[model samples]
Target: MTTQEKRNLIKGLIFISPWIAGFLGFMLYPVVASFYYSLCEYNTLKPALFIGLWNYIDLLTDDIFWKSLWNTVYFALFALPLGQVVAIALAVLLNQRCVGRPIFRAIYFLPSLVPLVALAVIWLWIFNGEYGVLNHFLGWLRLKGPNWLGSTTWSKPALIIASLWTVGGAMIIYLASLQDVPRDLYESAELDGASGWHKFLYITLPLISPIIYFNVIIGVITTLQIFAVPYVMTGGGPARSTLFYTMYLYNNAFSFLRMGYASAMAWIMFVIILGATVIITRVSKSRVYYAGE
Candidate 1:
């Protein structure tokens, strides 16, 4: 390389050296160690005994693993799409020429700023079986509400409902992307005597597909790694209805002291997430449009 090119490369490396050091020191070692540990049977105090694919085989026969996977899949299936719809609808509404729009945006986004523990606490009360706001309101209308977290039938749905309260961060991103869209597209659609629905269909939807794709991928990743809310509230209770993948993994690792098994589970989760992300990103490329790409 030329002297100037070499100098530029050196400057870039110097700037990124901290990140490189951290990645190698922390992330890389743990990732490789986990894969190796997954093949062993270790309980922290005991020496790691290499057991080949036994851990993998055990997971195949494991009921809790499957149950937790199902719970997590259910969470992702409903939460991802529902949260997207709510965020998008709110974004579209906020995009309107309404009075106090800034205040409205702030109000909508405030919930996302609340700590996850606080959010879970508030939701616990909201979904409480008796003497709770939701149940009390239902009682006022002479309607009986189910014991949400206490009942297997309603626990997962209640958790999903609780998760929707923090769609504000995604909504903000979508709103910004919406604002970046070209106005001429809408103007031209109007000149064609297109109704609002028609304009949104032919103009807005196409333009915003990229942002939607972005949000969906993020939502999927976050939903899969979900641990805090269910951990705090249900403790994976009501017949394991809310026993999510991460919670199960946690139990295996710390509670059960199955470090090797937990490592295997973590690797499996990594593979599943990596595969899903790859598929989504590949599929989205055809549908998502960059404004001036």
Candidate 2:
């Protein structure tokens, strides 16, 4: 190679060296090691004994595994779309010029800045069954409130509702993308006698579709890995209504010391996320447009 080409190659490797090192040391090794572990029966004290596909087979018949998967799917199904809509709405509202807009945006984003554990604790207080703020307010209005964390029926919804409080981070991203949309498009639409909603439908939505796609992917991945809130607030209680996939994985790895089983579950999760992301990207290409493309 020429000296200039060698210099470019060296610079490229220098820039990527940290990522390459970290991936090998932290990610690649663990993933490969985990696959081997998944083929064995491992407990912390005992050496892993090769058990072939027994772990995978057992997972198929395991009630807890199925229940955890269902619960996670439920959480994601409800939380992802609901959170995205609310976040986008908040972003749209905040994008407008109004008095104290910055303050309002800050208020909306405040919940996201709170530590996860602290937010969970505060939500626990709000979701408390007997003397909780939510129930008390309902009582004053003479409306009956369902037992949220205490009942199987309401527990998942309560978790979903609590999660909505943190949609501000997503809203901020959407707002930033919304600002980049060309102002002349709206002006041109108005000159052509398009209604406000029509302009939004034709111009604004198309321009922001790329960000929307990104948020959907991010939201799915994050929601699938949900652990802390449900763990802290519900403990997978009320008959495991809130038991997420990650929670189950944690229990098997640490509480039950079934590291091999946990490794299998981790791989399963990775596969699910990867498949969903691929499907979404493929489907979105028709709608999502890049400016220069």
Candidate 3:
């Protein structure tokens, strides 16, 4: 409407232009292309040929698709809850006033900074049935350690365990949330002779419920897309027990040259994650507390 307003608007657009360009080139284009590709049969060597809903139809009858879905579901179910508990516990500990607090925080958080591939490689050795550190420790305790990665029954569980090493990132978020909880509430509770557990259960948990909701949504999304660690560590495993959805998608796209099929799977995963997040947000609506609420 005015020269100054127009200049300010232009300057604002200029400042965010990199992000806009990136969103178009990297995110938006891929999303659009993936949707189109999902409707076709593609091999990178040749152009995609449209095939309508055949990919979705085939996936419905596909055993591996179901198996991968189930495996992914199992991983997400266990990983999210366990990781949340561990992160919150760690956060609570770190929230305490103590000696070497910064050092302890750094030590706990360092694992999350390790590359997933590197972490997987390290855990691969750690979970070795024989002559590995974990087994050796079990042996010292006169306990037998099963073949973790080699066993179909245990492989997914092992991956879940390994991935928990990165719960430090979640811990940091929880710790920050913990700090924002009103100190006066705790002091008031103390005046009433409230025990530590009582204070935490009634006050701290309520205040940090929003963070829990945020982290749960994030965990659900992240765990659903779990690929790197299992891909590197178990190669989807001894009996395909760890054949995650993404791993199968990768196989279809690269291993089998079924790019269109992979695209379909990606879209399905997107829908599932989106639905789950929405459901979680809706379910958490009443429980998640903010200062004003």
Candidate 4:
């Protein structure tokens, strides 16, 4: 290369050097180290002793690990679809030309901006068995409310309900996608005697299908790693019904000093998230619609 070209390349590299260094130190190193630790018996107090798949083998027999996995999956199954539907519905309502539209949108989205721990604390009071706002309201209607955070049967459902409170973030994304749908398509469909349901099913849905797919992929990843709220509220109580995967992983790493085991769990979760994302992408290949061919 010419001297001028070499100088230009060096200048360009200098401009991006910080990003390259950060990626190597903060991202790449941790990932590579985690994999190595996963294969060893490591605690923070002692050196990592190479164990060659023993941690992974132990996980196969760990009953609590299996329980945590099941709890996470159950929560995801209900939380993901319900959150998507509610967010999309809210987006659609907000998209309409109505008075106080901005006010309503702001109200709906404010909850997502609240800190996760603070949100959990607020919900803890709301879900209390007696004298709680929810149960008090149910009392007036002669309907009894269960101990939400205490009952194994209802704990997961309670978390699912709380999960909906943060749907505002997804709703904002859906609203953006909804606004981009061409107005002429809806007008043309109306001219063809298409009803509201028909227009939504045949036109609106097809146009926003890509956004829906994007939300689904994100929902899968986040729901699988859910931890904070359950940790704060129930502490995985009432027979470990709320012992999610990440919470259990945290306990192993910190509480039990099983860093190697926790690392293995983390890698397993990584694989599961990757597989789920791939499956969703494959499924959406034929369903998701882009604006242009």
Instruction: Write down the TM-score of every candidate.
Output: 0.94, 0.93, 0.95, 0.97
Which stretches in model 4 have alpha-carbon errors above 4 Å?
Answer: none
Candidate lDDT values, in order: 0.93, 0.93, 0.94, 0.95
lDDT of 2 by residue, 163-255 (tens): 998999899999999999999989998999999889878888899999999999999999999999889888898788889999999999999
Greater TM-score among 2 and 4 belongs to: 4
RMSD of 1: 1.9
Residue 231 of model 3, lDDT score = 94
Instruction: Name the better of 3 and 4 by lDDT.
Output: 4
Q: Give the candidate order by descending TM-score.
A: 4, 3, 1, 2
Taking the tens digit of each residue's C-alpha lDDT, what string does model 4 give over 233-287? 9999889999999999999999999999999999999999999999999988999
Clashes in model 1: which pairs? Answer: none
User: What TM-score does model 3 achieve against the real structure?
Assistant: 0.95
> In candidate 1, which residue ranges exceed 4 Å CA deviation?
2-16, 140-142
* Cand. 2 Cα-lDDT: 0.93
Model 3 score (lDDT): 0.94
Q: On residues 1-293, what C-alpha lDDT tens digit does candidate 1 reach at each position?
A: 99999999999999999999999989999899889989999888999999999999999999999999999999999999999999989999999998999999999999999999888999999998887798999899999999999998999999998999999999999899889879998888889899999887878888999889889989989999999988988899988999999999999999999999999999999899999999999998898888789
Count of backbone clashes, every candidate in sequence? 0, 0, 0, 0
